[model samples]
Target: MDVRKLAACVLVAATAGCTVVPGSNMNRMNSVWFDDTPEEYTPAETDIQYIPINATVLAHLNQQAQKQPLSNAELEAAISSYHYKIGLGDILTITVWEHPELTIPSGSFRGAEESGNEVKADGSVFYPYAGTLYVLGLTTSEVKDLVTERLSSVIKRPQVDVRVASFKSQRVYVSGAVKQPGIAPVTNVPLTLVDAIDQRGGLDEDAAWGDVRLTRNGHTRNISLRSLYEQGAWSENILLQHGDQIHVPRNDADKIFVLGEVNRPQGLPMSRTGTTLAEALASANGINESKADGRGIYVLRNTGISRDENNNPIYTATIYHLNAASAVGFMLADKFALTPRDIVYVSPAPITRWNRFLSQLLPSIVATDRIGDIQNNN
Candidate 1:
């Protein structure tokens, strides 16, 4: 035989070995393959290329929850924790002792004609007798001290009281899964995570009951709401700080999987509304029409167990089988909800076994290419 023909035979043999033939008798088997229904599915040895549906759903849910904004309750709680300080946009009400003429009716020492008392861009407030006094970064007490010293020179024993009328200077941001989201006014009142949520009008219907997150100074901390309310774990209720952001993200982590002989074998989103086997199969693009043995559908799940220090067996695997052709199959599907990474395999028909056997034998026959070619050429 020519070298070209030998090379062709080698190539065909190699390629055929890589091809897989579906089993034909997978549907005809009447006996159940599994003892009990598994809680989770394990991937087959041949499914190295497939993605783990549980991990995919987890990643997807995490992404969805991160995009939500903060609620109003969170904003108010944040504001309450802030210490009273003087900053831009703060309205100060200054009162002068025994000086009705100097004290304007509008509460500003600058007089009613000059408008409200405002902290200037340079951090100074213009008063009638005290001119421009820098008050930025100073607490309410500090501002009063500075003003009294300035007034000592102009008025005879000038008594002054400084109070913040509008708290627009300091604020905290609260967002995600809440009714109202925005910057909350900061005050001397202590604000906790629960108070923040209350200020935001409470968590939405889809809010995650697990962990609520607070971001501040480029650091993030996860606080469990369920632990705080249900478990009575008040340690999870952290005090909010100024410029802190409270976020109540939604729960999107619930999911189920349908794999193996299904056409679109993958993870399907779970609904609180409930789901059935037929529905899950439909979501996974339905069973493989040509390859699936409709008679012997099996759901394989791993029993949760871990090896101890002595290497003793800690877990046992459970399996469940349902005849797709049986009347009770649909009911079983609804009763058995698929968990993460569960494997659903549909066996092939009996003829598929013959085809696979023939495929294996075909490689040997092709090896006799030299004799066949010589016979044909002769």
Candidate 2:
């Protein structure tokens, strides 16, 4: 359908639904007039704790933010004591002193990886003089000492060296919102969670760095990359182990919804670094100055579950009101922090966005009708 005709139809549908009351001059109901009484309305039931934004609230919130998140002490201990032990499918190069037959030389013809002793499923490898040595969960230095002791029976003052040729047994898989989702091999050098992420090409642009999940054994834990990188929380950077899974989820769930009287209403993703309420408002192009009440700005935050006086579980929510009509409003907004999934609403929005749209569109509708009539006459 033509835009002119569509607009005319819409206007007619909107304005033509008026019913006049009998024997009354001003009983006609239309867009401009409404006979709705205040008693006919039912306000929604809400348990709102409308706390005003002030220094006291700011201090309390700041104190809560200052409470540092505890790190994994057990994981930290394991990481500190961790040493690379030989596992099945791992390749090891055993070099014997003054002996060329026992050693697999990584020369121009074959690399060390190609000519290395692969650990069997039973975790034992057979060398020339060492026979079969069970080296499972044994470090390279231990294996070297074992080979030297075994060779001492045949040769006098036997020397041996053991090194990992290729690490294929143990790996940590990095998936989800990373630049490259792949596996990072466990090596002699310690591989931390951050190291594995870096190996997989770091986090993607849409990654919620604070929502990373690490699955070890059968259990999983939420690990915040922001705590490690931005807040200097070294303890949060736990070491990655074999069969571990690291997943950085997308930031879609971490977006703050901005609605109600705004110049440009939008959903802004929460930054892993930090995002203030002022920055969120700026992203939505500020408030609708004419229709919205600047002093009645509210931030609705879900504070999770809380118990009522009866001890029964009840859902808890907080409504924080900010008076932004004063000179220090912007300063207050700058200090206010917004969490993920928070909703911002500018109050007293008497006129809706649709009303603005119709006002702008009415002139064009009238012009189009005039043009159509002129064309019909010609």
Candidate 3:
């Protein structure tokens, strides 16, 4: 190997050693500091916790995993109990048994079976025998009872049936990162978050399945589809109501960025399957065996300022380290869940890097500097 060229590379790198600008967001989010440093080394205002990766930590983290609000049974019950109300512009088909003459008029443009009576702006629908009956704020079953009562005055033992012919009143708007973005009408059948999305032919390729935003009556909530599929959390499939807006956002959580002495540096896409440190490293072909300090594997998690109960701004910056030299280190890495936009870094061996610098890198840099000096003198 060209020893002079190798030394020059190290000299240039050493001259510009790792720097952390104090009070910078980037510094707090991306730390290259060693784990062996004294505890007294005051971190920025952010309460940065440096945790050593171990079995206990993994178990605790797994237990603290956030669970979905609704279970499968609860979701099913909600669906079964859901009832849709009549709204203005809703078309209803009113049927009267054993009274065909009253129900369907001969020479009528639209047949009784195919025709529907629309709920007018006054919240009333005009029927042949029932006259103008109020249906807005009532269910299909309630409308049936009202029609039956009104028909009894005209005919003896009247049986009436009411069904929604065309649902056009209550609807939910679906937009952004979907195959089709538009208003989906709510019918007598139950309408759910999943059903609404499916009606539009499912989400587009760029849709952020993990961060779906739902706005209902000006109140917005975020739902993670990742938790639904992975944890089977049924609550994520919530029932969509009237005037509800659901937007499938594009995946912009960034990436699980891995850098430093790893064999392959990359910004890996975080998966719903819960990407762990070991999986990320494997994708990057693991840390450099020759130069990597197994004791210095660190994962930096950047948390923006969050307000506490007292409304005080709390900066909770967390960094996790794995001592890969230990037998259990790889096991711990396998269980450590990586959050989106996390930064994983495997540092070079401190002693080896310094030795290389002193033996070759430093010499080449000095020689190059002296050569420059000689040229200037000439």
Candidate 4:
């Protein structure tokens, strides 16, 4: 071959040798470029928890108060006479005009018990002539009319009056995820589920904001408080019923776990301000400079519950490559939206990993003391 051609051939051979091949050392090194691993250590634990980002966003979204628009059914129900049934913890007072003795105590005597009175286990007071009358559910007018009808037969021209002495029978329960959860009185004051929560001291910090559960009669309905308050979906502020229970579960599903090479490897709570991969890294004390390859950042997402054609359950996993140098990368980190129990990993450079492995094998031989000093100083 000519001298010039020979020289070109040698140069080409050197370039070819250096070219990266899949599964080769050069390829592995490149792979480690953006790996989310620490330089001097392997992941101490792989079972990092996942949290949903949506829940955090929703929580902040519910801070504002919005009036719930009434639906056709709700409107109709509101217009109609709602006869509330009496339950435990109710007291009733009855009076009969003209007939002093029949009027019970002969005058407007306000005492615990007087003439011709009956108290119910569910907190309702009944009258002898009124039969098994449940004054607990009846309004003042309804109770009066009922008593008048019964007295007509017993006494000559009997005029009867009925009133509630104490309101303890009608109550609704608020529990879970709320600041103060307990039974609240449902008095003449009209109250909705939101009002009940407010009366109970609002939702707790860890309460999930997406949907609060209304469990009644063994059936559950999800009400989105955030949407009701922020998105103008007022339908969520449902009117509460006696004995109805509202449960707010903790926001355990709205946090992300960051591990491997991070200074503070732990689970971080997500919020409405939103979180970015970079921000999360910073929150966890950033990646170990010596161990982290800025290029090898990965996000593992769990796509929940799928079914195969055979009706078998299948779980799918997704791996995302994040670029730290680009603005888009930061945006992705912020927008990626983590769910409860999500795992974020950063792989180290090949040289770093090798050094780490060697250090583990022979602590005395490796410069771990210097590495620790550098880490401490940094």
TM-score of each: 0.47, 0.75, 0.79, 0.58
lDDT of 2 by residue, 219-325 (tens): 99998777677656666788778999998999889999887667899999897777888889889999888867777788889887666677666667788888899
What is residue 77's positional error in candidate 3, in angstroms?
Answer: 4.5
What TM-score would you give candidate 4 relative to the actual structure? 0.58
Instruction: Tell me how many residue pairs clash in candidate 3.
Output: 1
Evaluate model 3: give its TM-score.
Answer: 0.79
Q: List residue ranges in candidate 1 displaced over 4 A.
A: 1-82, 105-115, 254-378
How many clashes does each candidate structure show, in the order listed?
A: 23, 0, 1, 32
Candidate 3 residue-wise lDDT, 1-378, digit = tens: 344566667556655763422111222446544577787885545577888888888888877675445477766887798887999998888878877666667667785436788899999999987788999999999998888888888888888888888888889999988999998888878898988988988888767788899999899999877777677777778888899999988766647999877889999887646689999999999888887888888999987888767777778878898889875789889889998889998877765455554664445567877776686688
Cα lDDT of all candidates, in order?
Answer: 0.64, 0.80, 0.80, 0.63
Candidate 4 stretches greater than 4 Å from native: 1-83, 93-104, 107-141, 148-163, 208-213, 221-233, 251-254, 271-278, 287-297, 309-311, 317-321, 347-378
Write the residue-wise lDDT of candidate 4 on 149-250 in tens digits: 877887777777766566676788888988788988886666777789999999887887666899877889988776565565656776777778888888
**Model 1 per-residue lDDT tens digits across residues 1-378:** 665467567656644643333233323323342447576955232211222223344356345534343334554565564556688877777778887665675445553324457787888888877888888888888888878888899888888888776667777787887788776666656666787788778877777656578899999988867645654556566666668988877756545666656788677665433445567777878777676666666665664656666765566444556667655665555555454345566665445554665676566566676567787798
**Order of all candidates by lDDT, from best down to worst?**
2, 3, 1, 4
